[model samples]
Target chain A: MTNRTDFPPPNANQQAFPPPAAGNQVNAQNIQDALEKAVAPKVINTSNNKNDGLNKCPRCGSTEISTQPGTGMLVCHHCRYVFEVAVAVFKDPKELIGEAIGTGAGDITIDETQVTIKCQGCGAEVVVNIEGSMTSRCHWCRQVLSLENQMPNGAVPDVLLPFLLSRETAKQHIEAFAKKRTFYANSHFKREFTTENIIGVYLPYMVVDANVHCDIRGKAGDVVRKYTVGSGDNKKTYYDIDLYDIGRDFDLAIDNLTVEASTDKLNVNNKMNTNNIINSILPFDLENAVHYNGNYLKGFNSERRDTNINDLRGLVDAQVRDVARFKANSTATKYDGGIKWESQDMDTKGSQWLSAYLPVWLYSYMQVKGNGQKLLHYIAVNARTGETMGSVPVSIGRLLFVSSLIEVGLLFLVIIFFLFLVF
Target chain B: MEALFAQLLDSVDLTQVLAVFASSDEDGVGAVLLLLLGGPAFFMFTYMRYRNTDKRHRHEIETPAEMNNLQQYNNFIKHLTRQSSSTITGANDNVVSGSLLSNGGASKSFKAINDITKNFK
Candidate 1:
């Protein structure tokens, strides 16, 4: 067991729990203490309040800021000066000791949608409706004021991944994907399909890093001999098998396991909507994610993180166990007859959670009536990697007709072949 | 009456029936069966192709390729043979014991942190 003292201290911005007061001992009591403390919410202050009230260009103090497409720099429209945001740094997965959550990842303590900010330019109070936009202009000085501070209402996140793909590029990707499925697409959908409705949106996600240990005990079988018995029609084959008691013990360090933080996106009810289509475009380049800035969201729309770390704890544990099971199964390939896991255990030594705003270009269409159920279709493109996936409403009648025609054509060929053989 | 039945049976040609069947081999029977079932099979195949396009990604089932401190144990047990038609019983295959978090209700035996030193013992 690794000593708790040997690990480095927690970050200056992060709050460590339980104090590790028991020193280097690894006992049931220490483990229990850590578990109890881990459940208690601890926030990491990731807010940068240097330019809290106003997001201005350092060169000319201009608030007209927007992200440069396919780049990490924020360009000022007035001065044309570009400011580069530093990429956010996180603890290494292997070094993670206990639960450390960002302040933005905390639960929604307040339900206030409208926030009043005192504009530094004119000292006039301006109400910024955070539900609709994070930035609003002051009527007195016409100076732009943005919400740069972390809000307990879950509006701000620890980091944000700027959109790497332009709107035009995402539109092209979506159009090309839809064109391939146009043959079987619903007639109503095809007639109304347009790329002009596509929008650039920042989706909420929780990025996790975990250190886990897994133990598994199971029974496995291997085939030894195979033979057939009895006569023609009654013949049967059997196997002589060898069984074994298998066990695997290992440690895993998982890095950047992303899960949806929005409740609406996590609802994968295939009957209601094609929400999984949005999840398909995963594996964003999170390493390039910069510290959160409201200027990056000037033109894009974003969804707030409604789920807290406690809510996602169970999901994270399940996914970690799944990963551990997958690892253990890979080593049991020698078991030709397969293995049955009788005892499976996964112990998360430590985990770190951070909230993020991931970029996605989305195009949606609702099918009013299909099979007596309405389904909302989505075509999502990963704004960072250009990975495109979508669901297109299909015409069942046309599909059935085409399939039947092909089957009939094949049957005719088979009959002709039989006739030629007879002749 | 028995003489009339015997005369009717002898009138039917058995050689003609056997000759007709023999002319068409196993391939002919297979072709006929394909023609009978090919419609539904082809329709299902095309339908599944379209359905699969909508749900092409499976990130949940995928795991990372890296690991550390991996130890494996496999002890050989007794062998037994049975005269069964199927090779696999499939009774214990892929059965994961204990409670899982994704099983909807509360889990009883699952803990995020189990006995860590149990493996060392």
Candidate 2:
């Protein structure tokens, strides 16, 4: 597909970017360079920084350094300089031998983050890389991107989904989702939940890996309840509970745990920016996730994941606690009244970090808020599995009407049953 | 204050409550009779039968939401195919949601990676 000139040039990774922010922009040569990088070059040459999105040719200063064939690398236009871009090292948790149980028990060490890259904006080196992959922004000048010598394929992802469910289908999904709420939805949402306003987008997320080993010690109880008829009218009730001490150790490996990387409305702080319907649209098949080359995201809207590993530690923590809690509960269920969890001790073993791109087919809206806030509703499908999740506009009148009908129906049922008993 | 004590005493033993009824001491003793006879019996029966009922429900609920035998089989096959080829590796069995959904004897249509390519090359 021919690249659009009207839009900004693509990145070497093929991950799409929002239009350039404010004043920061890259030259035409950068776009050309990025486009050239999609298919690798036969000979290693580093001559110019052609019109690529964010890549540069180190040799003869030509921004047009094409990628080496079969390998997504930068080749010089004048001199044959072959440099392999460092990809993220993926370690699946299920493959690991031992899993840690809780948090803070491990000797944690991070790769020194002093690695810096040239900022297309300030022409200075900026630091990046927590796990892998240079970001969309230049650290020094905070520029959106400088496609000086970027190859187009660099902006493509290993896996991508073209939009499914036209705006009409998306609108329908949103409307259905909103029908139940009696209150707390935006006023304009009901009226504006139409198909005409939908836009397709690709959001970024991080799938994390960690081997968890938990040593849990807790109390579980089986509750037996019975009633004894007393002499005369005396009645007594007692709950017989059997309690015990429990300890267990199990290794758990979580694969593809996710945290959003996009800075859009569906961010950590603003769940409303994107519709929550996406949560119900579970289980996009990630098994088909190919390697990240970044060329597929051409005309669509895409955003980088703003949340980092540190930011998503809470998600991981919650997951570990859940496992521990489930384990405790399952053991306690051997008796009754469910188990009362008195205390828990957990630890984290070894964590493996991977950056993978998951596929989504989204149709959504962005509504401006009171103080320049934006709220959005989405009808999204897991492009790989067609698992649809969506939110629609709910009309107050419709909700009240439906609620009254439900109430009336319930009242009718109660009356019918009452009459049945009476008759 | 008197009401609280009466309730407390009522909770502890039923003989006195029954004695009060036999004696016809209170005007609203009628309400107490119905509750004393009705509520406890219902609760006891439910508690006694909880295990069998709970097990039955758990077993029945796991059945896929929408499918006859043939349709469910087809859906399962389709799901497996999508999983094999789709880029959505996360859409595997691990996730509870979006696993299987069928309607009226037909299998759910899942999106899958139609084309195959190696990792981000």
Best by DockQ: 1
- What's the DockQ for every one of the candidates? 0.14, 0.02
Predicted model with the maximum TM-score:
1
Clashing pairs in 1: none
lDDT of 1: 0.70
Candidate 1 on A1-423: residue-level lDDT in tens?
221222222236634222234433478887886677576635667886544468889899989999898775799999899778999888777766667788778778998888899989889999988876788889999888888888788889998899889988999999998898888888999999999999899999998878877777777778878787675555556778787777777667777778788878866544456676787788778888888999998888888888876666665665666666767777777788767777777777777788999999999998876335567889999999999988777677787688778778878887797799989
Off by over 4 Å in 1: A1-33, A39-41, A50-52, A223-240, A370-373, A411-423, B1-57, B60-66, B80-121
Looking at candidate 2 chain A, the ten consecutive residues that score lowest on lDDT are A99-108
lDDT of 2 by residue, B1-121 (tens): 2123223322433444445455442233444343444433332222212111111101112211111011000001111111111122221112111111211111121121101111111
- Give me the candidate number with maximum lDDT: 1
How well is each residue in A190-261 modelled by candidate 2, as lDDT tens digits? Answer: 555554545445655544445554444434443433434354444433444444444444444555444443
Residue A175 lDDT in candidate 1: 96
* Distance from true location, Cα of A261 in model 2, Å: 2.4
Q: What is the C-alpha lDDT of each candidate?
A: 0.70, 0.38
Model 2 regions lying over 4 Å from their true place: A1-89, A92-198, A224-239, A263-275, A327-336, A365-375, A405-423, B1-121
